[model samples]
Target chain A: MRRILRKHAIVEDDWTLDDAARTPAGLIVPLARWRAERELLLASAAAIGVLLPNTEDVEAIYPQIADRPLIALQFPTFTDGRALTQAVLLRNRLGFAGELRALGDVVRDLVFWLGRCGFDAIVPRPDQDLEACRGALDELSVAYQPAADAHAAVWARRRMRASA
Target chain B: MYRYDEIDRELLKQRTAQFRDQTRRFLAGELSEEDFRQLRLRNGLYQQRHAPMLRISVPYGLLNSAQLRRMAHVVRKYDKGYGHFTTRQNIQLNWPQLAEVPDLLAELAEVQLHGIQACGNDTRNITCDYLAGVAGDELVDPRPYCELLRQFIALHPEFYWLPRKFKFGFTGATIDRAATRTNDAAVHVLRRDGAVGYRFFVGGGLGRLPLLGQEMNAFVPEADLLLYACAILRTFNRFGRRDNIHKARIKIVLREWGVERFRAAIEEEYAKIGASAEGGQLKLLPEDIGRMRGHFDAPPYRPAGEAAADLRAQAASDPRFAAWLKRNVRPHKSAGYRVVFVSLKAPEQAPGDCTAGQFEALAELCDAYSFGELRSTYDQNLVLADVAERDLYALWGRLDAVKLATPNIGLTTDIIACPGLDFCGLANAGTIGVTHDIYRRFDSLEAQYEVGPIRITMSGCMNGCGHHSVGHIGILGVDKHGEEWYQVTLGGSAGNDAAIGERVGRALSRSEIAGGVERLIRAYLELRSDEEETFIECYRRVGMEPFKARLYEAEGESGKPVPSESEERPPGESGQGARAGMARRGVAAA
Candidate 1:
């Protein structure tokens, strides 16, 4: 039987019965509402996951839920990629060792910045191509600065050499 | 000024590269004009009336001699010879080609400076009291905190695109010299229980609508500063109005939600963020703050007796020299050392005007005499922070030779006029011309100081960029009959007790402007209880009625005052003053 996650709907092969049961029941967290439910969601498995209301919402909440089992960042639109970038910062800066995911109407082009920020998995709409979307991550080998996902401090390395 | 770490330099370089690519793509028709407009604005390039102007962040108006020299080089190489120091403590270059802006940014990166977020709808350069670390009454040095905020907010993923521009100002001094009441969010460093923290105020702003910030947090512990600021930014991002660009600022959110509701929202958000420890750890530790304070070490000073003796001798010998010394020099906390304010408001020159060569010369002087540091004040004056008493004459001579010294620091001619219609498209009237008129009127430094200390500020319009609202004798340019008229206000101040100047009466014709100002000063001199009381104190004591009566006395017969006889008609308004007998003697009128 094939099941789908209602929020992002990225169909996974290794989902258990419990995962499937919880997938359909997702809550839409407005920016303010997310702040109120942050601690509660961090401790609860029943909540499934929360949606980012805006860019600032993700930035404010990212450090707190970096280690959570499942987290989804919502982008209101593709043009303003601030929230998606914030999700990456959570994974990168704060070392948010958790399942990083992207939801909402995220465009294919933005997948690069999102991946750079730290999103390992992206769940675009059912109409989008999953295979092509995955290829977006492999487009760029070198980024000028060390972003959320990248472990190497490229700027720091340059500075060390200049001083040496 | 703090030197940038490797991280700062790297970030600036990367940012320049990113902007270069963005600009290239835009030029190649890969991005729409609207998209490019936002992108360019984020990088501090603005499409102004004449050209693309770039506003470079000075970061609390603090610069060492080396940084200033570097900026001078940039200005000379990439832009016009001069730069405009803005009210928010940023420097604006009026003439930089749009195509060359990316290159300019690259050059600035080499100096560890960039125009990032200088004009964007994001957090702008954080301003603080120009005397932050040096002020005698400063409880804590606000530079480190300002620096921390600068780093955190720069390219912050969340706040890069807020509903409107956000401004934050910090002041460590007991006196509110940073104009905290006019910023979007202001942090006042205060001492609590022998520990340092901040008293946070939010929603304050000036412009079309002037509002004082309400105290959001009574006391924010040092550790939770960034977290709480983030919480506030998050709340504002979510709740601030996006429908109207004019009303979308955080100030509007505070107005709609009320301070109580707004504070509650931030507190609620703070609670959800959980233990402030994680965010607190990012803040400068107490020891780090102390270490930073050590960088701003005070220079050595001799005893005060020798300095006083030298000043007395100068006064006895030269009246002009004495008056200049009295009005322009300020006593430093250290004895035998003084803070010399280099007045930029010279006759016919733009306020804060300094050529590239002049900037270099000033930097050289600072390196030699002072401790290699130069501070740009809110009032558009530059400070040689550590001038020795013995070197005063030599320093003054060099400054005068360069035409950098005007001998009018806080007097009538030391006017804080905005770039008005000359460079800024937002202005309605020309402020630089009005400043010229005032400078010509108070040409004699002796006469100006004799009349006593006065602050004459002019703003082109009601936006108050020149801080006209707080000037002791504030002149605002008003447009009437397709000609520029001057509206004068009195008793405004911006010290511990700040009050907006009250309108004295009717606006003056451009020609009668200088005479009208002269009459107002004469009235102030006559009405003052004592010579010691400044114009503001006297105005406060007697009110505007006496000044108004004196100003409008000549027009008593016609019920409309004819322009003063000793007034020079505005450039084009000569026909209106045909009947005046004194019109022929335009020398006195000017």
Candidate 2:
């Protein structure tokens, strides 16, 4: 299969709906294009992905695509990770139960927080070390508090007693 | 004072630990500078022009004697021996080494204080009127609501990252002493049908735009206060501008959405939340309010009676004591008690500043006689609450010993001045020097009170740190010829009806400022309706033209204006001679 950067992931040029529809089985689409061709994309594709503009935008649109096959959240920049965190909320609270991937400028150190925030897969930039980045997520086994991941609430943690 | 229960204590302990870990990682080079910057700011550390400034939360500016003592200890041990009280009711210690900050924070946590959310693009320390519980004219004490908001917003997960900092202030009194108009959102407590509730205003802000808040809700029943606030935050999270940092505050959102639409959105979200109405969730019941009121009961005080009479007689006998009594003492709401103002404008020291030693002394005084309460006012003065009438003489004697007792509380030498260009990076000119010069010129307490109730506030720039816009006699330091020149404004008031002061034509030269002020006061003295009319009322009755013309008039042979000299009487006749003279000499050196 020919490899091409997903139109939504690249900002060099404007990508049409046809370009995104023909690209691959699993690829993220720009928020505007995703919303515009959501029904058409849903009818034609095996899985659909969307890049949210912000946490608020994700909240407003999460319910509409709760049962979608695969959802990918793109962090426009690593500086503000609020949207990526909100993607975790969409999966945990709204019960999306799908492949949750993180894309766009993500690095090795952020993998742990990304996992805690419910990202199963992270797409690093072309030049970065993907395997090492993935390994970074497993470096810490015990989390201090319950985030969007496996740990319980802080109150619950305090109440838990050790096994006899 | 609200005691921290187990949950509150654990939360603070854990938060401090988390910040410590974060600091460790940043020092170990694991976290990037940008990432650490955001994290550190969330914990109330800011990289200012000269050093790392840590803003300690005051929680609506309420502090007990013990808390203050701890703060003083922190200043002495970790920081330089002083802290600057900010407009938002927080305290900023300007010089703390980055390495020692965690220890400083750990110390703060022990006193139920922390720097969390104090200097970030998050909800900052919730401010309320400094005189909240004690003010006689208050409809209800707004501290409970302020406390509730403080707890609700502190470390809120969703709002941890915002486009810009959010500020909220509450006032129970009709007089908006808390500067509610200059906050992101303000709750004004209003009474309706014998029940107290809140009126919500949104998008009010001070920096750059300086727009007054617009009323978003006519009345929010006390029960729905937090829920409604959450809804508004959610709405702003969704719609507030993000692309532009300047336009990112809630104020801009309200402006863009318009008041009507924003209100409708908040109300719609509020209805969806479906009034949880759980116990302790909504407005406090009358009994609950009364219980809270019990927490703020007046501390034990004994009537001085004849002792106060004797003190008054002694004060009258001594001109210095008389001046001090007039300026420093205020009638207490309680019988035979008085609110003693501790002036921070001592000579050669920074105005509105106290050394750690002075703070400890004040704390000792607070513990001994003043009901253990200390208040930091917006005018940068300190109030020792619940002073016994009998202890007045003794307290004055002790305060005088420390040089903390300057008897010019609201007089001319008791000038409200900013750090100006000397300390603040955002200043255009130097306010401290100008204020000093003015203090030197009108040094007589008798002359100051003779001038009568002149609020001479100065700001280095238009940001108005000294609240120049509301000063009866306002001076804004403007830069001309690369030298500092001051623009004077007359007839502004921050009381029941707040008004921004108007400029009186040309800016005055640095040398001519004191003379200019003297001329203006001379004009007021000459054209008074009665001695009862304050500087504000007098300016209102007779417009700024007369004062303006007199001020800018060319000086003659005496090296100063003849008008100023003729109007100037010796100290006692001026009504504020002794205290004013002391304040002028003291503060001018500052």
Candidate 3:
């Protein structure tokens, strides 16, 4: 069984993704099917999400699925960081506040950076341990450059505490 | 010398643990070789030709006596008893076992020294004018900004896998002592309208394609420096070529896209990045500057006192000390202080290679005479930045005794050469042997003193580690039919007018380098109009033709690069050269 890490803990994955023949709901579709059968998926009552490839033209896809329940960003390889850019845009530029899940090649090493880049859920590759991923988040107590995370940089934090 | 706070200390400790774990995983056969290589590179560990070479960063070339002693102990205990100082103002141990690097890194963390961001595709140790704080002509000390950049970029997640490694340097002084323009991005700190800002220059590089950095912004407010730098790197990371390693550096991207387009992209990225919520976090707070300046404040100095008069009398009375004084000593910003340069190019050892014994003595001297701090100059010599004028005589005696006082600072014999074939895996030719040969030719202090200031730089290959491209007389080692051939370039300068040296003619053989250098120096001495005219001044006044003519056509006969038969096999049926085709890593044709 696949486990999803949400809010720094293992959580049950609710959303079902079926690519072959779309069942009677709860199916996240690829870009082609989502565009081709857009009216059917949109009108359906079951909650659905879209899986975005690392190379997705996020700007073009943004207008189409502005109100999707969730977005699953795929990392083709851990080293390929295009999805991180897409995630940053999704969170800040497009105001994506709903579920943002990272899947495929989500190794333990990339978990901390992925969290900083606005991913709320991670589905790590088979080789990566879920508990190890949790530990990666607490590795560094300080970050000089602020990521998309809510916390201010350590420098700012240090200044605030000093004044307080 | 930004001292680490509790937060900063935690970050380093965490990073060391992470690297240690990764190294452990790799050694246990869990991680792949290629994966381990990329991971190890960011920590400055390289599987070199002979053994693993670890480059330890000396941030802006600043080190205290205790840190120096620690390095001395580490190197002596680990692999070799010495380390090679690099052009980037870092130190490289030529031999270390791969398995021991993790333990070594843990040890280095104790002294606040590690290989973090010293190599690989990240911002190189932010370099600056070695005389930054102490220089008389400095507008503002660039160290605070350098340290700021250093902290901001170390283990920065976004820049972990840039298309190529990026180098950043800055200088507040009017003269470009740090070779600021050769870096991928540089800041020339200036105070305009009573506000300190920086002039950002981009795309200037030396290597396979060398071009002077173009000024991107005349003045960027100090608050936005880090944000702007981040935007530049992000832009490069997105658009730079990852397919071809040869054309991977930001310079190539900037060149191919043209400066106007590249500038537009960067500005767009900058504005986007600025608009983001995270942007404000990286901005420099006023307290940050105040905090850093406290650490770098000048040590307590005594009044120049009777020492100035005593030194003057000593200079007049003693010719040897006078030569040493005239060459090695320079004025320090503080009263009663003088900067003394200790040349690493001693009699026998390679240029910039200092042994453990040397560091031990130097550390003791620094603690006694100076303020227990030693700064490494970009020219590969060490500096006693805050040496008192009173102790100048005593320090010189000690230095001369150790063979460190060569009296060749900024003179003809003070040569800088990279460890070409002798140590570096990327080198196609030898550098130390040539520097030693040339140094001995101009051995006499009287002869070298009379010849005057001439900058000679040599690189084993196009990877201009020796910074050969900017030398007043640059020598690049090219492999000709598996044999070493030295190519000479006459008019390079790393000063305000930074220009890459142009080749004089065809390349010369290994044996011909020292003789060729002597002839060029002789030509300069003869052609110079006055005694005040330096070699560069004379070369600039009279173009490369005169010097080229003298070296090539002694009696008006075209003679260099005589068509010779090659004993080494020319090429295979594939038409590839005898030597393997290797990508030039910067030596960004400065």
True contacts kept of each: 0.03, 0.00, 0.35
Residue B336, candidate 3: C-alpha displacement in angstroms: 1.6
lDDT of 2 by residue, A20-128 (tens): 4265555566667777887877786445666665654565777766666556676665534465446645754466677666667675545556776677656665544
Give the C-alpha miss distance for residue B203 in model 3, angstroms: 1.2
Tens-digit per-residue lDDT, B272-386, candidate 3: 7678765766677889777777778877787767435468899898888998898999999887789999998887678898888888888999999888998887788999988
Error of 2 at A1 (Å): 16
Query: Which wins on DockQ, candidate 1 or candidate 2?
Result: 2
Q: What is each predicted model's overall lDDT from 0 to 1?
A: 0.70, 0.69, 0.80
Runs in model 1 deviating more than 4 A are: A1-164, B271-283, B299-309, B478-490, B502-519, B548-590
DockQ, all models: 0.10, 0.12, 0.45
Over the stretch B1-590, how does candidate 1's per-residue lDDT look in tens digits? 66776567766776787788779877998656866787788889987546888988888887777778888888898887888777777788988988898988887778777888998678898888877656677888788777767766776645666778889988988988887867788898888998888889898776545566778888888765676777777677667776676788788888888889988998886664445433433444555555445555555555677554477787778766675577677777667787787777777788887788788888889988788887787788787877877777778778877787788877888888888655665555677766777778788866887876788888866667788777888887665544456778887776667666787877776676777788889999999998898888888899889999887666444344444423423321223222121223221221
Error of 3 at B199 (Å): 0.9
Per DockQ, the best of the predicted structures is 3
Error of 1 at B471 (Å): 2.7
Candidate 3 pairs with clashing backbones: B204-B213, B206-B587, B206-B588, B206-B589, B206-B590, B207-B587, B207-B588, B207-B589
TM-score between model 1 and native: 0.78
lDDT of 3 at B201: 91
Clashing pairs in 1: A88-A117, A92-A148
Q: What would you estimate as the lDDT of candidate 3?
A: 0.80
Which regions of candidate 2 fall more than 4 Å away from where they truly are?
A1-26, A55-164, B256-258, B274-322, B479-482, B512-515, B554-590
Top-down TM-score ranking:
3, 2, 1
